[model samples]
Target: MKLLILDLDETLIHATDCYLDRDPDFEVGPYAVYKRPGLDLFLSKVRSQFHLAVWTSSTRLYAAPVVENIFPHDVDLKFVWSRERCTMRFDPEHHDYEWAKNLDKLKRRGYKLEHVLMLDDTPAKLARHYGNLVRVKPFLGNLADRELFQLSDYLPTLAETPNVRRIEKRFWRKASTSEP
Candidate 1:
């Protein structure tokens, strides 16, 4: 199966120290975490078509419990990598530092780049591997958000593509809606 790596934070759930207007789905330390709408259904549907994993810029301490609460126990993650796995790079455009997930690490683990896809809200985090990315708008505790629902419908379409990197994904939302 093709590997589908997901991001945490704004990509799947919105975690903040301050409370939002509504109660959070779960609490992790000082953070109140809100699961993105349709997260459960998204994971369930995508699990069958891809080898799922998580790659987050947050510490393992923060990412673990959030992942536990949001993900179903039946869906086994191939790997759950934390910030320690990311490389610190100085972003020339943004004129600051950022933690970038280098997909080469997966390549070292014997996974081919062509068969891997990463879903993240921050394109900067995956700057070195944009071709493998399917960027989503950042989720920020919006109860009515439906990005995951649209994503679940879009992702399965790539399950059979031999080289996912060859596909242009910047306009994924439009592509998803236009599909027959």
Candidate 2:
């Protein structure tokens, strides 16, 4: 199955600035904007073809409200994994665990690093790790760009890629052996 993991925050939704003020009635930030031109349709199309999941660094408490507000009720909420499930990495300077643990859950699921497509705005987290990541700049104010949905446009190319298939096979084999 094709798995598509999406990040929140600057990826799917754009906060006006870096910080988001909490408001129960507001779906987005005070100055935040929703780029809705084709996003809902795009998501619907992809959902028909692949298994979808939300793998954000935001805590479940914080992320749940945003996703609930952004997506329609008909959309399945099965694969919503969050920061608590992520593997934390120590940041010596900050004395905190940087949010990098999400990948570990995917790895544990036996997904080949390549069979998975991660759409994240954080280049620093994705750049050196997986081969299947499609990094996007943090959403400034636009989601209508053709480039933002490049993965959907290039699904055929992604499916036909040999290296990705090989990785998937290897991961599956490893999973089979490790199964109890």
Candidate 3:
């Protein structure tokens, strides 16, 4: 099976630090995390096709709860890694890239390097593994965004291919001319 790495904030859910105010989707006490529309369905679909895992720059203290909220008990996720698991590096050449999710580290952890794919809102985070990346649009609590659903439509194509890197998505090709 292929390994699919997922980002936390903005990729799957939107979070805010406001207390006593709840987002329309869900609330997590002092913080409010909005679940992207069609998230549950999308998760179920991908879980069947790949060995899913959550890898994020957020701390476990915050990320774990948000993950539990959306992923739920029924959704079977392979693993969850927080900021501590990330390689904290700063490239002297690029100043903005503070935290990059290095899939090279994941390779050492037993996930097949070539068979791994990552879905992340931040392109910088996937710079080291661009070949395996599906650059997801940042979901900033927008209820109208259809990226998740659009991604669901594209996933079956990836699932059909034995190696994710070998996928030449017609959806991506078609989207470049119109939408993504």
For residues 1-180, what per-residue lDDT tens digits would candidate 1 score against the true structure? Answer: 999999999999999999999899999999998999999889989999999999999999999998899889878899999999999998888999999999999989999999999999999889789999999999998887889998988888899999999998998898675333
In terms of lDDT, which candidate is strongest?
Answer: 1
Tell me, by TM-score, which candidate is best.
1
lDDT of each: 0.93, 0.60, 0.77
Each prediction's Cα RMSD? 1.5, 9.5, 3.1
Ranking by lDDT: 1, 3, 2
**lDDT tens per residue, model 2, 60-82:** 87677777876777877548878
Number of backbone clashes in candidate 3: 0
lDDT of 3 by residue, 1-180 (tens): 788888989999888775223435666666778888789988988888888889999889988888878885876777898888777677556775467787888777777777888888886776666778888878887778888887877765665566776665424535442253
What TM-score number comes out for model 3?
A: 0.85
Model 2, runs deviating above 4 Å: 17-33, 90-97, 160-180
- TM-score computed on alpha carbons, candidate 1: 0.97
